[model samples]
Target: MYAVFKRELFSLLNSLMAYITIGVFLLALGLLLWFFPDTSILDYGYAELTGFFSLAPFLFMFLIPAITMRSFAEERREGTYILLATRPLTDWQIILAKYLACLVLVLFSLIPTLIYYYSISELGLPKGNIDTGAVIGSYIGLLLLGSAFTAVGVFASSVTKNQVIAFAISVFICFIVYTGFDAMSQIFALQYLESLLIGLSVNEHYQSISRGVLDTRDLVYFISFVALFLGLTRFVIGGRKW
Candidate 1:
């Protein structure tokens, strides 16, 4: 598992894909937080990262798929998947290793944005009137959200040998999981059903934590979501060899 993890990480860093994904994330973050003047701008009286975190999910919908698109799809396309399958690693190990690699890459891209916190602090009216607790909570929610999306992408990649199809499917699935539930709630007739639908959405839980609530239910929802997708990915890959 460790060897596979290292190899996956090394391959991602060695490729242009990693750089391009990170570059796009940073560019979007900068534009939304700094360049685009709106209510959340530094000079607009909003010291918190409300706008930044709000934009994170949409950006990650594309970025996470880009990172995970080639995880297994490209290997299968190149016929290296057979070689990997013959190795001593179990399907779960392989999936976990690849998932960890993608998670690390996503987290690495996020670390640089911490500078935005300091920038806002220095520029605030009272030298840091920003809601630190909410910022931290939002970052945690963003990480969990990204992890779930990565798992979904990995599962999508495992189902197909074509990277383009994997990317498309991953993006579509992530979009659905992230926002589909809320949309469904609007169309539901029963109030109970509508409430349940909204509760199932990634965005709902994300918004709860983003407000600095740190609800145990929200944390569990994210963990369960990621685990469910990762388990499905392992099952899919294992069945392929049977």
Candidate 2:
């Protein structure tokens, strides 16, 4: 499992595409938050990273899928999945290795953005007036959200051999899981069902956590969400081998 993990991570880092992907992710977010006069942080007149936290999840819907679309998809497309299946690793181990590799890359893309937090903190009128607690919570929520998206992306990639198809499926699934339930709750008439649907939505849990309250329920939801998709990836791979 460790070897597979290292191999996957190393393969990604060794590729020019990996760097390009990270660059694109950062550039897109940076331009939207810093350059566009209309929506720029300076124009917002608030010394907070609310814009970043708000925009990141939406952008990640595209960025993360693009990164993981090639994970198992490329392997399966090139017939390398057969070679992988013949290895000593279990399907779960293989799935985990690829999932973690993608998660690591997601974190790498996020680490550079911490500078934004620093910039905001210093830019505050009273200096360091930003809500550190909420910032910390938002970062934690973002990481959890990114991990869940990565798992979903891995599962999507595992189900198809075409990277483009994998990317499209991942984006659709991630977007639905993140906000579809909330939309459905608004449409449903039953109070109980509406509450249930909202509770199931990723955006709800993410927003709750982003408010600086580290609730165990939100943590459990994210952990379970990640596990569910990873388990699905294992199931897909196992079924393919059979």
**How much does each candidate deviate from the true structure in C-alpha RMSD?**
1.3, 1.3
Quote the positional error of residue 234 for candidate 2 in Å.
Answer: 1.2
* Candidate 1 root-mean-square deviation in Å: 1.3
User: Cα miss at 46, model 1 (Å)?
Assistant: 1.7
Could you give me the TM-score of model 2 versus the true structure?
A: 0.96
| Model 2: CA > 4 A from native | 188-192
Model 1 lDDT tens row, 143-182: 9899999999999999999888999999999999889989
Which 10 successive residues of model 2 have the least lDDT summed? 183-192
Worst 10 residues of 1 by lDDT: 37-46
lDDT of 2: 0.92
Candidate 2: tens digits of C-alpha lDDT, residues 122-152: 8998999899999999999999999999999
Off by over 4 Å in 1: 188-192
